[model samples]
Target chain A: MAFLTADDIALLNEPQLAHVATIEADGTPHVTPVWVDTDGEHVIFNTAKGRVKHRNLERNPVVAISVSDRANDYRTLWIKGTVEMTTEGADEHIDRMAKKYLDKDTYPFRKPGEERVIVKVTPTQRLSQG
Target chain B: MAFLTADDIALLNEPQLAHVATIEADGTPHVTPVWVDTDGEHVIFNTAKGRVKHRNLERNPVVAISVSDRANDYRTLWIKGTVEMTTEGADEHIDRMAKKYLDKDTYPFRKPGEERVIVKVTPTQRLSQG
Candidate 1:
């Protein structure tokens, strides 16, 4: 039975850092923590173009995301989504999205050798249980 | 084309904390970082009885676990498995399992209000991509 309701989706729309899981060509899962912003309709996050996550998404876009309260047993939101990548000057967009998860003024805006990419995910499924 | 072979599993079996994903009643996924020992044949971890993760398992046994190198783009391991809970003086077993993930000399051994449960998961599927 489906457990998530529209209200639950709204509840999860807030800004937060979520753990993103990606499937590798070998069927093994690759996971990493990322800063994200939910627009109620989609998930947005950013990373470098040469990263494993970027490579995995290009190979296959299926992914699962989990967002939980840092403290134990408070609340959690899980999102099953597809990867959407853009190539035109995406670094600026990615940097902006990343800043939301950090202290704006002090966050490392970018590192010299690091190239960034912007990714938007449209969730195909969502699960939340508290 | 499996990304992980027996050797990779063996490499991951060494004591480590993995992020475990559980399905919540609301269909939202709950994820928590946990101390785990991979037995090659099975994955074992522990948690308190009334915890959300424990409760989630009682409702549904399906789970996915992700183990990754803290450093960027190194390696990742994913295990899809079912839950196995044991009730007998499981606290002792849990304490022992948890200790393996920590420095024995200074780990928090026990707390009065806490109740521990032992969980054994035999992975049905694994995915690793770096």
Candidate 2:
């Protein structure tokens, strides 16, 4: 497996958005933007259970994430990885993400009765460009 | 097939980068950041021949592209489409893109003996969010 560099970790720590790609059942690609995080090893993102991405990842753990610096488009990272998802601590994780991305105490868009899932991706390949 | 709204065309006119996803032969997803454009109908991007994305597209025309406003991440566009690639006018297209993206009269990174290809996406599905 590939590992994220210090620069990659630093990039993830920023509040930039990640464009995540997952394979649909028919093998078509589905991509959407998400707030991203990292634990210095795994790339992390949160989504609601039963969401399109959540469903896609449940069936196919393989994922591709593209992140570019908000201020510098040339500074970019592409990660191909397999995800391990769980509901544990997903609420807290979104709260942290909200704080990072929105300076809010909690995710304001959270829906009532919605279950959150944290997707932790172990990088099989990491590509960086500046 | 879904059509690009005026707002989508306006977004494409901006110098924002697009995160493009294509399926690998193994059915895994590959995504990268690319300079984007639109003709008010189709989403267009240029890449060199023999690249992984180029080869992937040649084999599998299915593609996904995500573009977000550089100033506002929430203003995003997701497109699922099939691409038509051609070398015709690709050189001129890259120059135009360079002018749009870099304010250059021509693409400065052109390599000797390298041929460029223009990949135009006919959107089958378009998703927008703000």
* DockQ class, candidate 2: medium
Top lDDT hit = 2
Residues B66-120 of candidate 2 have per-residue lDDT tens digits of 9999889777789899999999999999999999999999999999999999999
| Among all candidates shown, the one with the greatest DockQ | 2
The local distance difference test score of each candidate is 0.64, 0.90
lDDT of 2 at B64: 89
The residue-level lDDT of candidate 1 at A51 comes to: 79
lDDT of 2 by residue, A30-103 (tens): 89999999998999999998888888899999999999898997777898999999999999999999999999
Question: Which residue pairs clash within candidate 2?
Answer: none
Where is model 2 chain A poorest over a 10-residue stretch in terms of lDDT? Answer: A121-130
Report lDDT (Cα) of residue B55, candidate 1: 93
